[model samples]
Target: MSSAFLPGFFLGFSLILAIGAQNAFVLRQGLRRQHVFWTCLTCALSDAVLIAVGVAGFGHLAMLAPWLDLAMRLGGAAFLICYGGLALRNAWRGGAALHAGGGDGSTLLATLLSVLTFTWLNPHVYLDTVVLIGSISAQYSDRLAFGLGAVCASFTFFFGLGYGARLLAPFFGRPRAWQVLDGLIGLTMWAIAAKLLVM
Candidate 1:
């Protein structure tokens, strides 16, 4: 169990470290420095919820079903194709042009909606955090430690992206940096989706 913890956390983090819509959104929020806490909080809490659900709901299925991986890969690929297209379009049209009306109320609402968009609409997020990570944990047959590791990893992601971003502020502070980052994320999503589909 103790050994499973490190492997589980590393597994979860490795899958999640890739570029995707959720990471794009979180990076945007971190760079904008607007409602950073709310955005990161929503992301972390949402992942925890989904991780729990996947562990509880699909725990048995992960071990029993062989086609499950195939279905998930295809589903994730389809979703990623769609999401990547939208993200690329957004990058071309400017997805980072957020201005929170210069009021506390507007900031809160905007932040909430932004996080909701990331939480609900991002397919990569669902696939990686909900499906892949959960499935991996379920493979252990004893996910009590793996589940906790996954939870810890989820929080670690938010903190790493939010707080650690301060170090990159000088570089990412530019609009061009956002464009490049968003564009790269979109491209990476497509490439990975294609890889999964082919495999």
Candidate 2:
């Protein structure tokens, strides 16, 4: 990629690097050893879609529709709150993977739900990774360069997220670690929701 595109690539990287609902979910699934490969694939693929949409200049569709923005923000906030609440509940209960016994069937379906949880349900994912990144890329007007940067950024994020979480799994084996994770996730989600309400 050209040097001019580096800034946008980093822009995408910085926006996604922060701990958020999607990251948390990714971490949890990684810990559970549940649909690990496909989970990463879906995350990257979803990012690819969003990045393509932005670099292609179709993100204007999102900006033009007030209802779209509101619906996404509202839905995102609600999903965060509910998921966070679940995390908090799990935290209180303590210990490794919840409902492990139920992990018997349909790994593909479970993975798909996890993908949706990270992609569609998380409001911050769209605003930061999709809208913000797209808008920034649009400023350059060199669609080719902007797109290259966006795709690079997406690959970096999903790779780090999907595999990076695995790095943390060894640590989660200790007692109460899962609880701490859940508590942190709950807080992260609620904080994101609060930020959304103001926007």
Candidate 3:
């Protein structure tokens, strides 16, 4: 059980650590200090549910739905491209900064909705949390332990990122820092979108 848990933990962490739309949004909201706790909680809980479903063998159901893949890929690509464009526009505007006060602040409901979209609309999340992780868990006799480990990884990561972003507030105080961050985020979105299109 311990052995299964460790591998699941590391694998889950490695997968989530990669820079993507979900992580980018979480980090941005975290830095802004807007509903960080709820945002992180939603993300972590969503992952927990998906991970549980995967372990319960719903991954095979996902595999059977070839059309779902096409729909998700198209939707995800469009969403990423649109988001990337917005980020680039924000960068070009050159006045954005991470501050407690407003400069495009959103309500909690809106923020959570966006977070949900970023998490669920992105096909990669399904691929990673469901198909890949689920398929791998079959190899272990202690699949429940492995799934729990993955859930732990999700909680650790989302909470850490959401809360930890505050530490970078000082650096993000400058407009230039925001520009750089937004630019990088834009590039990441486009890159991922390209990958999705190609795949």
Candidate 4:
């Protein structure tokens, strides 16, 4: 269980560490010092809910159809590989950078709505939190521990990103920073995919 927890934590962190609209919004809010806590909490909780659904649903489904476990593993690995390739390609192209300025000055409610939209409406979130994470959790003997680890990672990352945005703003402004981040993300994704394949 303890072993599973650490893997879950690392995997969860790696998956969320990728750059996306949701993360960009959180970073912007953090930099602006606007509804930071609520924004982070909303994103974390949304991930928690989805993670729970995925872990539980997939576990049961795998139980009913034993072959599904292998199928999902293969599918998740394929997805991760494709995603990693894209990240690597982005890294090679090396021109992406965060633009933290020019916020719309939206109200708290509006901001919350926008973040929610970014979270719930994104298909990638479903793929990452639900299908991918869920499928991976099924491989662990202690699925609950794995799920908890993932949940904790989500909370830690969102709060950190939301509160640390100001600190990260300068660092993220450079295209080289984005390239390095993308490179690391690509490597991490491929590593996880390799592990899944070996399992």
Which candidate tops TM-score? 3
Decoy 1 TM-score against native: 0.66
List model 1 lDDT by residue over 123-157, tens digit each: 55566666777777767766767767887887898
lDDT of 2 by residue, 5-86 (tens): 7877787778777787777776667666677667767777787787777767676676577787778778788877887898
TM for every model, in the order presented, reads 0.66, 0.84, 0.94, 0.63
| Candidate 3, run of 10 with poorest lDDT | 96-105
Q: CA lDDT of each candidate? A: 0.69, 0.72, 0.87, 0.77
lDDT of 3 by residue, 1-199 (tens): 5789988898899999988999998898887788889999999998988888888888989767789998988898998999999999888887734443243668899989988988998888988898888989999999999999999999999999989988888888888888888899999999999999999
Question: Quick one: best lDDT, which candidate?
Answer: 3
**Candidate number with the higher lDDT (2 or 4):** 4
Would you list the clashing residue pairs of candidate 4?
none
Candidates, ranked, lDDT: 3, 4, 2, 1
